[model samples]
Target: MQWDGISEFVYVAENESFTRASKKMAISTAQVSRQVSALEKRLNIKLFYRTTRKVSLTEEGRVFYQHCRSVLDGLDAAEHAITNLHSKPQGKIKLTAPVTYGEQQVLPLVNNFISQYSDIEVSAYLSNRNIDLVDEGYDLAIRLGKLSDSTMMAKKLGKRTSYVCASPRYLEKHGVPHALSELSQHSCLLGTLDYWHFSELEREKSIRVSGRLRYNSGFSLTDAALKGLGIVQLPDYYVEQHIKNGELISLLDSYRAPDEGIWAVYPQNRHLSPKIRLLVDYLAEKLR
Candidate 1:
């Protein structure tokens, strides 16, 4: 089967107009019509019912359209793989990540990676809001949570634990909460969610924590916690060095928060591009 002809037929069927399909395919309208006609002749089927106003697919055309789509998709994948072999994975790779994670963890590695692979260009966006990878044309994203999209592929890089922490000054004044239930008694810095999820003695738990101070940004919440204002539940990355330095002490050690795993995610593709694969592997190795 002529893959080019089949591809042209699929485009025409999708557009329902030879002129529109030709514009999309960057070919002459006459060439588009010729290719579709050639494909129909080869298949020995009437692929479309043409009219003055518009074109509609015949019964045989619907079946041929499905087959053409599959065949053309396979051909495109094959061509991309072959082209990738000759290419040195040189292109702009757009990535999205949480602000704190991107700034503290990913930024350092990106600098090193770019230095090593001078050909690869990277653009990293640090934002907490979920982005539409396909719509935005992002090559990859580092996501930290449960993935809800079945359309994308994700590789687990590592697991992260949260810590309920407060400054020594706050602990000295307000005292510490020995039990998870006691968290409500103390002032707390809240994030987007008013409740904190945790686990204790093999059982899961949730605590409704309130605070005088609240912020949507994690950095702001961390700063509030550092100022000895109230207790805050935050990821280990934000508080680890502080915990080590005794700037912030972990409270309620017996109760563990729900762990969130870091993942490198990308839109599902027939063949993974070398650039994305390399970066994902590099992150997994570095984080692990």
Candidate 2:
């Protein structure tokens, strides 16, 4: 089987235009058409449905394209690994993390990493949304809490615990809740999640919370809590310093859930890049 035909076919499928594919592959239009035709003839199937205006993949073409894409991805990974085998970590690393954590922790570490490895560049996207690492072309991501994607590889960076807290003024105005059930009596400043984490006799629990003011940002929720609007459940990074400064008082300590693991997640590619591996290690060490 000729590899050129497969490459041409994939490129054509992606662009949906023979001319565009030819340009992208730096080959003539005749060459691109010849290779794709050769592939279809060899496979004994129609790969594309062509009209005067556009090209569309046939059902068979779509199936073939999926397999071809995976093959091309593997080939690219192999080439990347081979090229960087002995080289210092160089090139751009695209990473994503939750906005608050990125600004508070990951950004500083990434700054330090670039300072140490002068050849490497970093691009970070701080978002609360769970980004598709492969589709988004990200090298790695820093994920907090539990990981649900079994397909990705995760390295534990450290642990973060949730803090249920309120300002002294709020506690004084509204008597502190003594137990989980008592949370219903006091207004709870809700964050993005619908439930607040807790622990009961070694078992993790999530209690549904409500508030007069609901916010998606931890900073906003903490600020609301500071102004005595309501109680808030937040990660330690947002509330720890305030707890020390007597701006916020930790509540329901006995029911505080087990610490959640912070992870550096990446695609489970066969050849993980050195830049990603080393950065994950650096973050783990610094966070620990």
Candidate 3:
């Protein structure tokens, strides 16, 4: 059987829908159906039990699927190895990160890297939603906070310290909060993480703070705080320039927020491309 047929079969089995498999493979649905049919004809057995709503593998199909998936995976590894041997890194590298961080931080570094390496092409997806790197064929991702994905390798770039702050005008109007308990009396601008934590003395403490406005985007909340709407807790990178310019002021100096780490993550099994490795190292150096 053609290797292409085997690959298509594996995709179909994993997705359980010819239409979905076709989209992923970048082929027509009819082509996917025909390849599976031809494979079934050659094997002289039904591979899939198909209904109008769903498709499931038959007994023979289950055994064939395991072997097909292994073969396809091995073929991908071989291709990556062959590409790496050519000396120059050349190919598309797909990456993802949070919207604001990707725009303000990752894009500049990516531009510098792309300028130096003309052969390497890069595509970046900026969203907060967690992406499946292997399943979606992404080369790598930049993630913040704690990582729980055991299947991927995480290279931590550095840690970002968060600050609680507000504009001088807002502080003058509402008065500065002397302690964590007094936050309830102020008009706080909350972000995705509602519960704030701080390192006091030798221990870390956390408290859930509510506000009149809650925003999903850190950029939005920072903007509100800049306009003297309310106090906001945000990363240092997001507010450092503003604070320096006297547009915002830091508060609760004695209590330090827990530091969040940034990481470069990729699937564990795939060969690390020279281009991706260089970019990751470059970012770690620049961010540090």
lDDT of 2 by residue, 1-288 (tens): 568699899878877899988987899999999988988888899999999889999999999988887897799888987888888887789999999899999999899988999888899999989998865778898999889997688889999988999999999999999899999999999876778989999998889988798787888988999999989999999999999999999999999989999999987543467887789899999998
TM-score of each: 0.73, 0.71, 0.70
lDDT order, best first, reads 2, 3, 1
Cα displacement (Å) at residue 2, model 3: 27
- What tens digits encode model 3's per-residue C-alpha lDDT throughout 36-112? 99889888899999999999999999999878766766777788778777688777889999888899999998999
What overall lDDT goes with each candidate model? Answer: 0.84, 0.89, 0.87
Model 1, 145-194: lDDT tens digits are: 78988667789998888999999999999998999878879999999898
| Model 3 misplaced stretches (Cα beyond 4 Å) | 1-86
In terms of TM-score, the best-performing candidate is 1
- CA lDDT for candidate 2: 0.89
TM-score quality measure for candidate 1 = 0.73
| Count of backbone collisions in candidate 1 | 0
Q: What is the lDDT of residue 171 in candidate 2?
A: 98
